[model samples]
Target: MDVRPAAEADHASILAIVAPILAAGETYAIDRDLDETAVHEYWFGPTHEVFVAVSDGAILGTYYLMANQRGGGAHVANCGYMTSSSALGKGVARAMCLDSLDRARQRGYRAMQFNHVVSTNTRAVKLWQSLGFEIVGTLPKAFNHPVHGYVDSYVMFRAL
Candidate 1:
């Protein structure tokens, strides 16, 4: 798979990958009913650098990396990732994450953090842990999962 910086024309493919995840309200904290414009802005906004994982000319996954905070906390990076449903279990996410980690380091980030990982999303929690992230904190009942109702969320971190 080829993972590279996203171009303006990649917006549609990014939206296609995100919309279902948003509608499910199972992982991300975004509002399910967000319009295309808002969703586009949220994913491709200036604050984050977005990338797409492509294979056979298809966008299989995407991720965004940015400073976890401004000024004093700028050394830490934050990221959000999504894989096309059809591409799950095919290592798409794993590849994107590895790429992001390298990209973060190259960009001078000293650490990476995931501020709100829904605890119920076991696959992601496990993936992050395997990649060296530690569950530093947990927010009880922080996320209102559509199917599971209120669920705990985790704050995961790792030094680059």
Candidate 2:
């Protein structure tokens, strides 16, 4: 798989993957009613370093990396990842995350943090753990999952 910075041409494909996930209200904490323009801005806004994972000319996943906080916290990084529904279990998210780590180090980040990982997303939780992230904290009943009602969320971190 090839992981590269996203371009305008990748917008539609990015939405194809992001929209459903947002609509499902499963993992991400974004608004479910976001229109295309808002979604585009959120994904490609100035604050993020967006990337896409492609294989055979098709986008398999996308992710965005940014500062976890400003000023005193700029040394740490935060990221959000989304894999195409059809690409699950094919290692696309893994490759993007591995690439993000390298890119984060290159950008001088001291650590990486995931602020709100839904506990019900076990695949992602396990994957992050296997990639060396630690669950530093858990927020009780943080995410309102569509099917599962209220669920806990975790704060995952890893030193770069």
Candidate 3:
């Protein structure tokens, strides 16, 4: 898959990838009730740089990179990833993550952090660990999973 900066034409595909995941309420700690306009704003806003993973003219996934915090914390990067449901288990997420790491390094970020990874998402946790991130902290009962009730959330980090 080829990973590159997202363009206006990729918005629809990006929406398709993120919509199902956001609606499921199984992993990300976001409001499932968000409307299309708000979702677009949250993903495409100026706060971050968005990218898409494509192959055979199809967008398989998308991710956004931004500073983890403002001012003193700007050296650390943060990112959110979403893959097309049809592309799961196909390494799309892994490719985007690797690209994000390279992009982070190119942008002079000193570290990358995931603020709230739901503990129940083992696939993602394992993939992230394999890619060099570590669970630096865990919040007790931080994520209210739709089917699993409350679950722990992790703060994962790694140097770029």
Instruction: TM-score each candidate.
Output: 0.98, 0.98, 0.98
- What TM-score does candidate 2 get on C-alpha atoms? 0.98
Which digits, one per residue and each the tens of the lDDT, describe model 2 over residues 1-160? 9999998899999999988888788999989989888888888888999999999999999999999999999999999999998999999999999999999999999999999999999999999999999999999999999899999999999999
lDDT of 3 by residue, 54-126 (tens): 9999999999999999999999999999989889999999999999999999999999999999999999999
lDDT of each: 0.95, 0.95, 0.94
Clashing pairs in 2: none
Q: State model 1's lDDT.
A: 0.95
Clashing pairs in 1: none
What does the lDDT come to for candidate 3? 0.94
Tens digits of lDDT, candidate 1, 1-160: 9999999899899999988888888999989998889888888888989999999999999999999999999999999999999999999999999999999999999999999999999999999999999999999999999989999999999999
